[model samples]
Target: MQKIVILDYGMGNLHSVASALQKVAPGDEVVLATTPEQAEGADRLIVPGVGAIRDCMEGFIRPGFVPLLNRCIETGMPVLGICVGMQIMMARSEENNGVDCLDIFPQPVKFFGTDLKENGERLKVPHMGWNQVQQKIDHPMWRDIENGSRFYFVHSYYVPAENNDALAGETEYGVRIAAAVARENIFSTQFHPEKSADAGLQLLKNFVDWNGQY
Candidate 1:
C-alpha cells in the first residue's frame, strides 16, 4: 500500500492536511509522522506549516528532523511543502528579523510590508483571499489544474526564487509572487491546497499520482 506521511513538528494544521490528502486519495494511507523514522519510511511526504518562519525552523531542528528531510530530498522522495513550509525551504527569510532557512532553493523570503500598493492603493500585508495562479511551466502536478486557476492564499511573506525554471506558478499581489515551485522530487506551494476549493483538490489529486517526474 502507498503511504503518504505528513511530518508533524507541531507547527502546522496537521489534521486538515491529512484530511485533504485522504479525501483525494482514499485508497492510499495518509498518516501523520512525528518521528524521523516514520517520516523517512513514507512513499510520499508532506511538510505543512503555519506560523513564523523562525518557529518553524526551530521546530524542525528541535525534533532532529532536518537531516531526515535532507535525506528524503536526496533520495528523490516525492515531497510537498505548504505555506511557511515552502518558505523555509529557501536559504533565508526576512521574517522575525532575518532567520536562516534550509537553502533548498537558494532563495530568500520577503515580507510584503504594509506599504505595498497596487494602482496607488495600499494592498493588504497578509495577501489573504483567492488569487489566480498563472502557470509558468508545464508540470505533472499541474496536470488537470487549468491555467489561471484561483487558489486560497494567506501569507505576509513570499518566495521569489532566483531560478525561473524552478517556478511552476506565479500570482500577482502588487508584486508577482512565486505561487508554486518544483524541482525533481519536490514541489512546494505558497497557497494552502487544503483551504482552496476545487482547484486545490485537483492539485492534491495530481500530487498523489505524481512519481517525482516533470
Candidate 2:
C-alpha cells in the first residue's frame, strides 16, 4: 500500500484532511507528520496550512523539513499543498508585511485589497464559501473533476495568474485568482478540497491514484 504523509507544522485542519484522505484511499497509509523524520518514507506528501503567512512560515521552518520537501520535489514524488499551504509554495507573500515562502513556484501571493468590486458592487475581503474553478490544464489531478467545479475557499490573499506559467485553474472574486497550480510532481490548490464535497473527494482519490506524472 502507498504511504501518504501529511506534514503537520502546527497549523491547518490536520484531522479533517487526514479523515478525507482515509475516506478516499481506504487501503493506503495516511500519516500526520510533525517532523521531517516522520515524513521520511512517504510515497506522497501533503502540506496543509491556514491563517497568516508569517505564522505559517514560522511553523513551517522545522530544521530538516524544507530539505526533505525539496528532495521530494527533485525525486518526483507527488505533492499536494492546500490553502495557505499553497500560498507558501510561492516565492513570497504580501501578507504580514511580506513573508518569504518556500519558492517552489515563482509566483507571489497578493492581497485582494480593500477596493475589490464586481458588477459595481463591493466584494468581501476574505473570499469565503464555494466558488467555481475553471480548469486551465488537463492534468491527472483534474480527473473525474469537471471544469468549473465549485470548491470551498477562505482566504484574503491569492496568487495572480500574471507571469505564472504553472497556473492550472482560475477563479474570479472581483479579480481572477489562481485557484490551482501544477508543475512536474507538484499540485496545489488555494481552495480546500477536504471541505469541497464530492468533487473534492474525487480529486483526493485521483491524487492517491496518480503516479506523479503530467
Candidate 3:
C-alpha cells in the first residue's frame, strides 16, 4: 500500500485533512510527518494549514525539510499544498515574516486590496466562504472536476506563479487567484479540500492515486 503523509504543524485543520484522505484512500496509511526523513519516505504527502506562513515554516525546522521536500518532488512523490500550505510553495509571501519559501513556484504571494469590490462592498481582507472555481483545462491533477465547482476557501493572499500555464483552476475574490495549481507531481490549491464535499474528496483521491516523481 502507498503510504500517505500529512505534514502536521502546530496549527492547521490536520484532523479533517487526514480524515478526508483515509475516507478516500482506505488502503493508504495516513501518517503525520514531523521530520524530513519521514516526509521523504512517503508515497504521497499532504501539507495542509490554516495559519500564517511564518508559523508554518517552524514545522520545517526539523532540519532538512526544504531539501527533503525537493527530493520528494524530484523523486515523484505527489505533494499537495492546501491553503496557506499552498502559498508557502512560492518564492515569498507578502505576509508578516515573508521568509523565502520552498521555491517550487516562482511567484510571490500577494494580499488583497481594500479598494477592490466584488459586489459593491470593499472586498474582505481574508476572503472566506464558499466560492466557485473555474477549471481551466484538463489535467490529471484535476481529473474529475467540472468546469465550475464550488469549494470552501479562506485566505487573504494568493499566489501568481511566473508561468501562468501552471494554474489548473482560478477563483474570484475581487480578482482571480490561482485556486488550483499543478507542476508535475507537485500540486496545490487555495481551497480546503476537506471542506469541499465530493469535488474536494475526488481531488484528494486523485492525489492519492498520483505516482510522484517515482
Candidate 4:
C-alpha cells in the first residue's frame, strides 16, 4: 500500500486534505506527519496550507521539517503542495515581508497588487470562486481529468509564467494563475481540488495513484 504523509504544520487544512484522499485511497495509509522524521519514508508528501508565507516558512524550520522534507522529495517521493502550500513551492514570495521559500520552482510568487486583468479593472484582492482550468501539459496528476474543467480557488497571490513546459494547468481570475504545476517528481495546485467535489476527488485519486511518470 502506498504511504501518504500529510505535512502537519499546524496551519493547513490537513483534515480535509487527508479525508479527500481517504475516499479514493481506501487502503492507503494517510498519516499526519508533524515531524520531518515522520514524513521521511512517505511514498507521497502532501504540503497542505492556507496562511501567510512567512509563518509557513518558519514552520519548516522546526526540528525535523527541513531534512525530512528534503530527503523525501530528493529521494523521488512524489510531493504535492496545495493552496499557499503551492506558492511555497516557488523560490520566493513577494507577499508578506518577502518570504524565502523552499525553492522548488525558481519563479517567485507575486500578489495581484496592481496588475489589472483583461477587463482593465484592478482585479479583486482575493480571487475566490470556481475558475476554469485548461490543461497546458499532459501530466499524471491530471490523468483522466478533462481540460477546461472548473476548480475552486481562494487566494490573492499567484505564480507567474515560467518555463511553459512545466505548467500542467492554469486558472483565470483577474489574470491567469498557475493552477497546477508539474516537473519530474514534484507537483502542486493552487485550487483546492479537494473542495471541488467530484472533480476534487478524482484529483486526489490521481495523486494517490500517480507513479511519478515525469
TM-score of each: 0.97, 0.98, 0.91, 0.93
Residue 15 displacement in candidate 1 (angstroms): 0.9
Better of 3 and 4 by TM-score: 4
Residue 8 CA displacement from its true place in model 3, Å: 1.3
Judged by whole-model lDDT over C-alpha atoms, candidate 4 comes out at: 0.81
Where in model 4 is the C-alpha error above 4 Å?
114-118, 162-165
Residue-level lDDT tens digits of model 3 in 1-214: 8888888766676889999998998987889877766665577877777777787776664455677777777877788989988888888888875677777888788877567797888876788888888887677767777778899998888876335767888878887788988888888899999999999999898888766532
lDDT (C-alpha, whole model) for all candidates:
0.89, 0.93, 0.80, 0.81
What tens digits encode model 4's per-residue C-alpha lDDT throughout 24-62?
999999999888767655889888888888888888667
* Candidate 2 residue lDDT tens string, 145-167: 98999999999999997677999
Error of 4 at 85 (Å): 1.2
Residues 53-78, model 1: lDDT tens digits: 98999998887788888888898888
In what order do the candidates fall by lDDT, top score first?
2, 1, 4, 3
> What's the lDDT for residue 78 in model 1?
89
Worst 10 residues of 2 by lDDT: 60-69
TM-score, cand. 4 vs. native: 0.93
Ranking by TM-score: 2, 1, 4, 3
